[model samples]
Target: MSSHAPDQARVIPLRPVPTEPTEPTPKEPLWRDVVGDVLRRERLAQERTLKDVADSARISMPYLSELERGRKEASSEVLAAAAHALGLGLADLLALAHGRLAQPTRPARPLRSRIAPRPTETQSRPGDVRLAA
Candidate 1:
């Protein structure tokens, strides 16, 4: 009979895995989406069509449509053109989008203390190290 086995198991050290927070943070809306929403909303409020706005803005209908759908990111000039077409200045357009972003998507979370809570009397045990505040 022949048996071969390692005298001791090998140990490998690795970085500790990161743990997720107990409460998942809400995702923030993309800037493109926010801007697109503002443009589309303003145009609709003015009872205008995509083609009409595109022509006024001097941009291709397809490009304007893509911007409205949040399918493409527009340059500052393009955004300004679109805003002008909708009878809005660039600042006005940005303010509208900012309003949308400022609106909260989720209910407010309860405030959490920044400091770690100390062990309660019931949780204290022999050989435990207690730190003074």
Candidate 2:
């Protein structure tokens, strides 16, 4: 007689193997691509040429061209000035930049309760205590 348990063979279930080949999904569009599209559209809508926008924005024409073509990424300050030259607000520009960034949204927090320290001792109120040297 065999020594193996009678229930052991019946108890364990078999796992199914995949029959089809798995394929990866295409990558999402880049931030530069989105920003480039926005910049191109805005400039076109205003009937402004690339040279005109670059000149008005006080940025180099080639650099602006690169930015518009998604070959370069722009910093916030640069984007703000560009937006301003396009008659857009800084906040609006920031929103556009965020859309290009496409980061996941985190929940907002309440305003900070702490106050910032003054640069100079004189800036502090007369009633405030002086710290030890």
Number of the predicted model whose TM-score against the real structure is largest = 1
Q: What would the per-residue lDDT of candidate 2 be over residues 22-110, giving only the tens digit for each residue?
A: 34534667777777777877888999998898888899989888988889989977777777778887687657767766754443333
Candidate that would win on lDDT: 1
Q: Candidates' lDDT values, in order?
A: 0.81, 0.68
Give the C-alpha lDDT of model 2. Answer: 0.68
Could you give candidate 1's per-residue lDDT for residues 19-108 as a string of tens digits? 335456688989999999899999999999999999999999999989988999999999999999999999999999999999988778
Candidate 2: RMSD to truth: 21.9
Name the lDDT value of residue 67 in candidate 1: 94
Misplaced by over 4 Å in model 1 are: 1-21, 110-133
Q: After aligning candidate 2 to the native by TM-score, how far in Å is the CA of 13 from where it should be?
A: 16
